[model samples]
Target: MNLLLARGANVSDQDGSGTPALHRATHARHKAMVSFLPENAANVEEKDEDSCTALTIAVKGKFEAGIKLLLSKGCPVNFSYKPRVSNTVSCT
Candidate 1:
């Protein structure tokens, strides 16, 4: 995966379920994989079938390291839910 990323793999590409590499990494708790992705992987902000971003999933899945990485990479911490609740407030 690191080699592929180095060769310019599309880190932002979504899977059939609209899950981005970041999302999968977070779900799998693959901290190294999460770190190996482009530093901007969190910034892609791809939404899954449930309209959840990697940051969102990371928080929900208790992937604290991934969440921290995402935030450090500038992923929007203030992302809001469709129902209008604030993600930052609720996720914490």
Candidate 2:
């Protein structure tokens, strides 16, 4: 990924489902990659097709290191997954 970044890969580019590198890293439980992406400019606030943020995925997966890393990078602790509902989930 370092090489990819050096080669100008977009850190924030999203897949078809809008899942970014940060989200994928968190989902995979790769704490180091999770840390690396944010440092490289991946947005922790980005959401996938399911309206899932990296922090949300981290919390759901119980990935402690990932959750801390995202929160430290300033990812929002509260966001609404369901439209017009509420900030139903709290990553913090």
Candidate 3:
């Protein structure tokens, strides 16, 4: 990843589903990658096709560390998985 970054890779690039590298790393539970991506300017709020943010993915995946890391990096805590849906899930 460092090499790719050094070569000018876009950390914010998204996949076919509009999932950014940060979202993938969090979903895959790759702690190192998760920690690395955001520091390099990966959009913490980038959502997938389902409108699931990195924080939402971390919560669904039950990744405590990932959740904390994302929160520490300024991920909005009040963000809902789907707007207008009263069913909100908690990461804590």
Candidate 4:
């Protein structure tokens, strides 16, 4: 991942769902990647299509490490996301 980033990978690039690497790393419980992203200029404020931030994904999934990492980095806690789709939100 570092190699890709070093090669100019767009850290802020989003998928079809507007999910960036930060969101994916947080949701996957990848604390290191999560930390690396924002440090490398990935937007801490980027939200997915559901209006959920990395912090929101961490909290919803009960990913303790991801939560602590994000919070310590000054991510917002007052977000209130409302998903546009009816897909089930995975909490694990």
Clashes of each: 0, 0, 0, 0
lDDT by residue (4-83, candidate 4, tens digit) is 97798998988776789899999889888988888888888777886778998887788999888888877888776454
Tens-place lDDT per residue, model 2, 1-92, is: 89998898998988776778788888899988888888987887787776778988887778999888999999997864333346344332
Q: TM-score for model 1?
A: 0.69
TM-scores, all models, native as reference: 0.69, 0.79, 0.81, 0.82
Cα-lDDT of candidate 3: 0.81
Estimate, for each residue in 1-92, the C-alpha lDDT of model 1 and write its tens digit: 76786798887777886778877888898987777664645444566767677778777767889888777666666665343354332332
Tens digit of per-residue lDDT, candidate 3, span 1-92: 89999998999988886778888899899989888898998888776776678889888778999999999888876765442356544332
Instruction: Name the 10 consecutive residues with the lowest summed lDDT in model 1.
Output: 83-92
RMSD of 4: 4.0
Candidate 1 wrong stretches, greater than 4 Å: 6-8, 40-42, 80-92
Candidate 4, lDDT over the whole model: 0.81
Name the runs in model 2 displaced over 4 angstroms: 80-92
RMSD to native for every prediction?
A: 5.0, 4.5, 4.4, 4.0
Better of 2 and 3 by lDDT: 3
Window of ten residues with lowest summed lDDT in model 3:
83-92
